[model samples]
Target: MIAITEGPINTQAVIDAVQADGAGAINVFIGTVRNQTQAKPVIQLDFEAYDSMAVKKMQEIANQAAERWPIQKVAIVHRKGTLQIGEAAVVIAVSTPHRKASFEACEYIIDTLKQVVPIWKKEKFEDGDVWVAAHP
Candidate 1:
């Protein structure tokens, strides 16, 4: 599952989506907005994405994970637009038959998502703001 949301991410909802009866292990990764960065106070953050491309890339990552691991389910949700500190920016939940595959696949999904997903973040600090690479 792949989605682009505009509000706070429901982590439990994501986990629930991926927890299937055959899945013995469920791994979840949540990316939250930090309040401080490099000694600056971050008020909030704004995220943007090429929805078509982002969703496609996320699907690719999920497909790759499915191919590599015996995963039962995969759910990836990314937030777009402004977010307050501590708000979840992204959520990834993967469940498999074993713990090892779940861990490895979960990490791979998030790492690859960061590398390839066309998502941008604007860190809104008290001092100023800066556009940087994907936030995790």
Candidate 2:
């Protein structure tokens, strides 16, 4: 499952989506909004995305991970729009028969998602705001 939403990402729901009977290890990655970037304080983050394209890219990433590893299921949920500090922006869950595969696949999904997903983030700062790469 892959989704680009305008609301908060439910980490538990993501995990539940990937639960499988034969999978023993379920790995999850939750990306949260941080309070600062490069020593500058941030007020909040506003995310925007080409929803359909972003979801397609996420599904592609999941497909690649599944092909590269022995994984049973994959779920990625990314939230857009305004978000406060410490709020979850993305949640990824992967289930596999072994722990190593689960960990590796989960890592690959998040890393690749940041690189290829068509999502943008605006850094709201005290001085001003700028739209930078969504993940940097």
Instruction: Give the best candidate by lDDT.
Output: 2
TM-score of 1: 0.95
lDDT tens readout by residue for model 2, 88-118 = 9999999999999999999999999989899
What lDDT is reached at residue 91 by model 1?
97
Q: What is the C-alpha RMSD of each candidate to the true structure, in Å?
A: 1.6, 1.1
Taking the candidates one at a time, how many backbone clashes does each contain? 0, 0
- Each prediction's TM-score versus the true structure: 0.95, 0.96
What C-alpha lDDT do the candidate models reach, one value each? Answer: 0.92, 0.94
Give every collision pair in model 1: none
lDDT for each residue of candidate 1 in 18-122, tens digit (9 for 90 to 100): 979998999999989998888888899999999999999999999999999999999999999999988899999999999999999999999999999999989
